[model samples]
Target: MTSPTTPGVPPPVVDLDLGGRTALVTGAASGIGRACALRLAAAGAKVRAVDRDADGLETLAALGTEAGGAVEPQVLDLTDLDAAEAAAAGADILVNNAGLQLVRPIEAFPPDVFHTVLTVMLEAPFRLIRGALPHMYAQGWGRIVNISSVHGLRASAFKSAYVAAKHGLEGLSKTAALEGAPHGVTSVCVNPGYVRTPLVERQIADQAAAHSLPEDQVLADVLLKDSAVKRLVEPEEVAEAVLYLCTPQAAFITGTSIALDGGWTAH
Candidate 1:
């Protein structure tokens, strides 16, 4: 006779079943944010993708439709609090993914550069969360996922502002999770290693010029050198992580920094 299935274990469920839920993802025009918009849409959630780039946002909306899903595209500068609040109205999930990074030595890091990075990366997310929490509390269910970075968990050279913003985002997530707990809302931080996107591509080009080395070698040796996998993360891989956390199985998983860093910090 076959033994009964264990109580704690069940069959694998790949699809997230997010019907009736609405997820608002910032920076959804491209890269990991774009991947996340598509992933959440495919999971059966209504999507609202926010970005400054109208063209890219439209493209993402079309991709969502092609994936048997659909998104309402909103063109807005996330740094503007009014726009962020307007966009977040009635949303059940908030993905704070809009960020800007400018890498240079501290001395060369202009004050203007710092302001832009902080405003976009940290302040916008803070405002978005603050704006979304009240609605989420009233609804009795919500998810706030902040996309930090491996640099947030640790540190690296020539990236002071970006690192600081990421670290602060993690702190914000923890605090938000603690407060949202009583209201049945959830919050989490997703820290991914460097992925090959246009953003990262620009970084690579800038690094090549600065270090006088080939871009490929810089990526292979410097970026992923300490990582166990020694490879840049794929956008789709990060998207999978986002969907995993959106599932009911992750109900108890909040107030944590989940890393998709190819074991970068495991060393």
Candidate 2:
């Protein structure tokens, strides 16, 4: 394992500063998106918190203000592709975190749900990235962080739409990284395994039904079964990784994924 401390350097510190930066975070009403918005704001960035949940955005903005961070709430449904693109313009940091999930086998999945999932998860990110790139290229500095999941890397039964969208996001992130590098922008994905968030909580019943297990057994028998950690990853943990990817120290680390999977992928 790599040593915790670098030779001749003090232990790492959380002193990242983004004083003059502006960040746009999608799905900022809750879960990983909410955490990322707060984390970026805490680092001194003016965060534009975008979501369809107006009340949740208001709550998040108030919490961010209490933490001495600037959080501007923007109510948006990502299905409006043009608006999603427009919302990303002029952002120094763009976090593509908005997503929806539907658990069903490919054959049984509704076409409409699959299309909606793809539009929100995959297409919105592309539009946001498209809108953010010009400013980034002109300024020659930017960060694009896609909040992907372990589903982006590994497939699970009964999650066809989610898995397909995530896999597409992984590819899109890489392409952005390659195209952004010369202009001093970095694009990367932060993949966490089954984060302890409202989204995951909502999926428990569906997972149980799919696996024919009890709802109480879903967490241990289905969700965490492949995870060596035996617990759901926290949204804050994933947020921390997203924050790190935006720092100067991580400038050269792009076109790759930082997995906070707790050894789920090891097997």
Candidate 2: 10-residue stretch with minimal lDDT: 6-15
Cα lDDT tens digits for candidate 2, 1-267: 546475644345645898999999999999999999999999999999999999999999999999999999999999999999999999999999988888888899999999999999999999999999999999999999999989999999988989999999999999999999999999999999999889999899889888888999999989999999998888899888989888877888899988899999999
TM-score of each: 0.93, 0.95
Q: Which residue pairs in candidate 2 have backbone atoms (N, alpha carbon, C) closer than 3 angstroms, thus clashing?
A: none
Among the numbered candidates, top TM-score falls to 2
- Candidate 1's displacement at residue 188, Å, is 0.9
lDDT per residue (tens digit) for residues 1-267 in model 1: 323355644335544789999999999999988999999999889999999999999899888898899788989896687777777878889999988877788899888888878888888888888888888899788999999999889988888899989998999999999999998788999988998778898888777766778987889877777788877889899888888888766767899999888888898
Candidate 2 local lDDT, residue 154: 98
Model 2 off-target regions past 4 Å? 1-15
Query: What TM-score quantifies how close candidate 1 is to the native fold?
Result: 0.93
**lDDT of every predicted structure (CA atoms):** 0.86, 0.93
Query: Which lDDT value does model 2 have at 206?
Result: 86
